[model samples]
Target chain A: MELWFSEDFSGGSRFGARVTQVVASHKSEFQQIDILATEVFGKMLVIDGKVQACEMDEFVYHEMLTHPALLSHPNPRKVLVAGGGDGGTVRECLKHSCVQEVTLVEIDRMVIELCQTHMPGLASRLSEDSRVRVAPDDASKIIQQARNMDVILVDSSDPVGPSEALFQPEFFQELHTALSEDGITCLQAGSPFLGPEQVVKMALDLKKFFPVVHLLTIPVPSYPGGTWCLALASKADWNPRGDSGQLIRQRFQDRGLTDQTKYLTKDMLGPCFEVPAFLMSIFRREQQAVAR
Target chain B: MELWFSEDFSGGSRFGARVTQVVASHKSEFQQIDILATEVFGKMLVIDGKVQACEMDEFVYHEMLTHPALLSHPNPRKVLVAGGGDGGTVRECLKHSCVQEVTLVEIDRMVIELCQTHMPGLASRLSEDSRVRVAPDDASKIIQQARNMDVILVDSSDPVGPSEALFQPEFFQELHTALSEDGITCLQAGSPFLGPEQVVKMALDLKKFFPVVHLLTIPVPSYPGGTWCLALASKADWNPRGDSGQLIRQRFQDRGLTDQTKYLTKDMLGPCFEVPAFLMSIFRREQQAVAR
Candidate 1:
């Protein structure tokens, strides 16, 4: 059996088709979330005919969010994942044997339940992890009083609708107070290639609250234009080249991590951060134009 | 007054505005080409609302194509460039004072006139080069009988409507016969990210004719996905690492040949060839599936 999902990314239109046998089909409260766990690739979470998440390309997002922060901090024993109900990020965090605890604060508990029930390939392994706890609650208010965390990952949806608060500077201020001095955070900062404005805006906002802010990019097939960006920030001076002690280079076939990754790789690390000169020049021109 | 024209490449659609004075507009025979010679980014060539070529970014493509061949051979004094009528390739070839002559075979005279008439920034530089001789002829038939050439560069359009012959296996066979024993050639293979199949086909076809076939990638904002691949082939084993002698390494920039580039850099070379795991597995599976 086979199935094909088409996303008219240029016009933001989506359509799906059943090429083979249908495993499951339904509608959820958030949107028409359909789970099609394929044998070739992994589980795929589709909403409104557009692919919300696919297991095959999820590692690009999960690794970019987790690895930068985990490697930045000296020791990351305790971690917090804000809004990743799919368990993919949690699964990646649990890979670190040094990490003893992980708390996933997702506002929509239904996303977690749907993923667990329909997309087992994505959320199944996390259910067996003893050090992980899935907490269903408002992430902004929940992290207001939290403290002593090594890393906090904001795996929220886009900046509108239910995830609007996640993109605000106030939410970042809350995250600023809820972490230890050595704490770091990485969040998906939209598409740098297609949405350069969003990247510049997010980097500017995070720079106001954090001492260091940098942007990274990764290519995913399911995503529009096949490229996306991740914003990394910390409360200390951060340089990817400067940090040497805690080296965490990700590869596809790393024993336990092998079965988890579909697209993330070690060779792709440096190129992901290499922004094109044309885009960088636009950013500079806009900055100088605005100053005048 | 200095004039500058910039193309808004924010999304899939590209639109160019006249930043200086409103210029005349007309259609060309080769394609719907628009020439906007500017002061900042050099001459801009617009085709079908897409930036076909810009003087600033053209150097990266021409340098990668010319240097690898000229450097690989002991002393490449004779060169032939197929379809690079803009004379960008000829200009780069002229850099080697050792080169006595360069033959530029272009199919369309319109392209040459367009550059000469409007794009003085690109064309004026070529008029001064007495070594370059512009021959109006079909490149496929032009290279067949040619002999004793130290280097031949197939700088044609993509393998579609007008360039279907360029990608054919027969053209590569003729190219193989035209070069000397140690002679080399480099063709612009399309984006590996979006056109993986095209790159693989070219690699396999070139391998049948040449002993050493290496694929190099450079990022170009005008191209789809900001990635471009180059296919190099020679009768002998041409190793870029081995060829980095004192002569070449001295000119080699820390960031690849990016000073002459707007996008292609040293950091972006390897990742351009690194296909996603799922894509690799699919390629492997298809090969295996076809063999069975």
Candidate 2:
């Protein structure tokens, strides 16, 4: 029952929490990951002592990370997902009939194995789909070699530890090169409340390389502040996922899939782009500072 | 700056911030209203020791309170506002040409005065309208005696403190007696976040009095949580307000009022009703509870 860290989403900042106990721990090659699975927010996935997702509400992140760009491409025949070893992104991509192939480039093969073992509900979907391809290799180089990917989803961790290069401009440049003319990509941007300036920096930088950039919002109960941001980049005016002629609704096909959601909503697709005013203002002020 | 209370809107009820220092304070007959307009999604409007509004962003409590019910009634020559003396409700009501008279029956008159003095930007256009009237009267009694009112806005504080009775079935009955047969009414039901139970209670009770009962949402900067809920009731079916053609696009008709607003979009009227899954579940649960 120990609280390790807390963040304020209203204004992006973190504070130390009183730690009660360490329920479970695992040391990954990159960082120490733990599964606190607190009673308050269902199961919590903590990585490097920071909350990564809550089982009860991780769908928001998984849906936003996978949906928008997947649906936007006219016909996404091939897809590449960087760093989402959890298999949630690939699971969502499998719903789209247009996606014929999906290659998940993840450096940490252990993460996938752990999820497939520890969290079967999420991992089961990956094994059920034949289109999914797992490449336990460095994503930075893997993305450079890939081509003809109509959609690319960069579902990386934060800009720290092994995920450091994922937030850099150079990695984004490679993502841009790897994407086809119609390719769309999304990145897991940090919380805009506590770390808004950083979110804005990435947003502005990404906008430079892509014609359309959108910041999607999702409420992740176990994250620093229970809020997370996803940065989406596309070469065309990409329509958000879920608005595709009720395609997801009609084709979800699985009666079980339709019932197990606590977070993903059809209406939430666009409003996630409706950034709070103060954050928008901060982004504006940041832009002003950069201009000077 | 003492941290009183802070609440995060990420998921569940985990994020809350309470400050010992009075961010904004006002003496009223009911009690002293204080505000801690945080840097969060919405400005947290704390009255006395409770949250009234949060301006960090998301949700539209302000627009829903003033627009729909106000626009529904044809040629609303006289208007009565049960609460919302802070002037935001009144400001939106003044946009309609048919609104010849408006009586703001706020129990805590000081909240209005303090709002006028401190937040002049929100209150500026409100009192200046010759058609508007400010009455520091007990709303329950005043509504019984009031007549010829085309629309009544129960823009009171939460059903806590002095405004507790405002949410009861009896109060809505009084509101029904006060308005004309075709008149409409809207009230600030607490956010589906903090008070989904209350929303269902009010919706059911209001349905007993008014023929039409519907719930709407708007984002306000001065509430406890980021999102807020507003209940809409009328003698007629609750339809979209924009179809009536009395929508307030920009704050006030004058172009001079543009610079002060933090957020309120013209196209954002109906889309505000999009509630997240967690809140919607509460509403559905409340509905089932009442049915039992």
- Tens digits of per-residue lDDT, candidate 1, A80-198, equal 99987888889888876678899999876667888888766567765788898888887887889689888899988777656789888998888888888878888888765456787
Residue A30 lDDT (model 1): 58
Q: Score the docking of each candidate (DockQ).
A: 0.18, 0.21
The candidate that achieves the highest DockQ relative to the unseen native structure: 2
RMSD of each: 7.4, 5.3
True contacts kept of each: 0.22, 0.15
lDDT of 2 by residue, B61-128 (tens): 55567765654565577889887766777777777766789888887777777677656645666668
Candidate 1 has an fnat equal to: 0.22
The CAPRI class of candidate 1 is incorrect
Please write out the lDDT profile of model 2 over residues A1-292, one tens digit for every residue: 3354453433432322333444457787776766554434455556665666555556667877886566556668899989887777787788776678999888877677767766665667666778888898888889878776788888888787878888988888888888888788888888655567888889999988998887765555445544567888988764443354255343333222343445545554444566544566777898899899
Candidate 1 local lDDT, B197-273, one digit each (tens): 77767877797899987776654544554456788888866455443433344343531344554443444443344
Candidate 2 local lDDT, residue A243: 56
